[model samples]
Target chain A: MSTRELKHAGLNLQQTDPKTHEEAESRVFGFWVFLMSDAVLFALLFATYGVMLSGTAGGPGTQNVYEMKSAFIETLLLLSSSFTFGMASLAMKYEGKASRISVWLAVTLILGLGFLGMEMHDFVKMIGEGATPERSGFLSSFFALVSTHGLHVLGGSIWIVVMLVQLSVFGVTPAVKTRILRLGLFWHFLDIIWVGIFTIVYLQGLTP
Target chain B: MNQEDRAEYRRELRSYIIGLIAALVLTAASFATVHWRLFSAPTGILIAIYLLALVQIIAHFRYFLHIDLRKSARDDLQLILFSTMIVLLMVGGTLIVLFNLKSRMF
Candidate 1:
C-alpha cells in the first residue's frame, strides 16, 4: 500500500492501490454523510416523541406497557451484535479465509435477528394489551420512533445476508470490501441510535 | 501475514473488545439505575441515565466506529459534528416552540 489509508480509515477499508484507496475513502465519506442525515431524521422523531410524551389520553403509557426485562435483554443483544459485526470487519481485513468472515457475519446476523424477535415480541404484547399506536399520541410517537430504528436494523440484517452471498460469489473484491465498510458503519450507527432509544425513550419513559 | 501484520490484527481486535466491555458496563448501569430507582428525584435519575448514554455513545463512535480527532478521520468527524449541530437546532427548536405553544394553550 502506498499509504496506511487502510489503517487510518480504521482497518476496515483495506484498499491497496492509491487510486483504489482514494476512491473507497471518498465513497465511505459519502456514506458518512448519509448516516448523518439519518441521524437528523431520528433526532426529529425523538423530538416528536418527547413532545407527545404526555398525550396518553388516559390510555396505557410506558409504565403500563414497557417491560424492563425485555428492553434490557434487547439492548444487550444489539450491543453484542455490534461487537460481532466489528469482528466480522476485522476478519474481512486480515483473515484470508472467506469462511472466517462468513462465520462472524452469521453470528452477527443471528444476534440481530434475536434483537428483532424480542422487539417484535414487545410490540405484539403491547398491542395485545390494548397499547396500540392509535391509542394515544404518546403510543403513536413511541411506536414511530422505536419502529423506525427497528426497520433500520432489519435493513442492516438483510444487507448482511446479501454481503454473505457476495462474499461467497465475489470473494472479497474491493467493491465487496467497500460495501462491507459502509454496512459496518450502518450497523454501528444503529447501535448508537439504540443508545438514544434505551436512554431517552425507555429510561426516560420509566422515570416518574 | 507478517509478524507486524499479526500484531496489528490483535491490536484491532482488542479495541473491539474494549468497546464491548465498556458498552456493557454503561448499559447495565443505565438499566440498573432505573430498575432500582437509584435516585430519589426523577430529574436526578434522568440526568444520570442521559449522562451514561452520552458517554457510551462517544465510546461507540471512537472504538466501534473508529471516529477520532486524527487528521485522516477529521473530515468524517466534522460531518458528524455538523450533523449534531443541525439535529440540535431542529429538535431543540421543535421542542421549544411546541412546548411554548402547549403552555400558552393550556
Candidate 2:
C-alpha cells in the first residue's frame, strides 16, 4: 500500500467509526500530557542531583563510585532498544503482521532487560563499595535519580511483555495499536532521559 | 503491497536507519571525548559533552518519537515546549537559590 492508501485506510476508518478515531487521538494526546508531567518529575530529580553532586560528606564521590565502561554499555543497550522498538512500530504500521511485530518487540524486550540487568549490577557494585544512599547527600540523590529511571525501565519492560501477550491474543486491534504507540513514546522518552543522566551524572562526574 | 507502497516503506526505513546511525555516532563521540582526553580543560570537555548530549536528545525526539514541526505535531510540540519551560524555571531557580545559599554559608 502506498502512503496514500495508508492515509485512505485511516480516513476510511475514521469515516466509518469516528468515535474510535477520536478516542484514539485523544488517548495519544493524553499520553503526551502524561509524558510531559513525567519529564517535570525527572527534571526535579536532576536538579536535586545537581545540588547534591558534591555533598559526599566524607563518603565516596561520583568519581570513586561510577564505572564508565558499564555505563557506556548500558547506554548502548538502551539506545539500541529504542531503535528496535521503532522497528516494531514500523512493522505494525507497514506489514501489519503480528508475527513480524512480535519479533521486533521481542528484540526490544531483550535489550531492555539487558540494560536493566547492567544497571542493577552497577548498583550492586556501588553498594558493595559502601556507596549506599545513606552514606551521603550525594549518594542519596544519585540513588534516587538513577533508581527512578531504572524503575521506569522495569515498568516499560513489563509493559512490553503485556503488549506481546495482548498482540498474541487480540491481534492488531485499534486499542492494541494505540497502546503500542504510547509505549513507543514512553520507551523513547526514557532513552532521552538517559542521555541527560550519562552526560550530567556519569560523564561529568568522571571528567575530573 | 504494491511497488509504490514498498518504495514508501523503504523510504521510511531509511530515515529510521539514518537516525539510528546518527545517534550511535554521537554517543561514540561523547565517550571518546572523555576516554581519550580530547579536550585538556575540564570545563571545555563538559561543554562539548553537553552540546553533544543536546544534539542526541533532539535526534531521538525527531527520529524515534516522530516529533516534527509539521502541523499534525503542533499540539505535542507545544505541550513539550511548555513543559520544558516550566521544568527549567522550577529546577533552575531552585538550584540557583540553593547553590547561592550554600556558597554564602561557607
Best-fitting candidate, scored by DockQ? 1
| Candidate 1, A15-119: lDDT as tens digits | 466688778888898899999999999999999999999999999988898888899999999999999999888887877467988999999999999999999
Q: Tens-digit lDDT track for model 2 on A22-73?
A: 6776878898899999999999999999999889999998789998999999
Supply candidate 2's per-residue lDDT for A119. 92
TM-score, prediction 1: 0.97
TM-score of chain B of each: 0.98, 0.93
Error of 2 at B102 (Å): 0.8
lDDT, model 1, position B106:
91
lDDT of 2 at A2: 22
Which portions of model 1 miss their true places by more than 4 Å?
A1-16
Interface RMSD of 2: 3.1
- Candidate 1 CAPRI level: medium
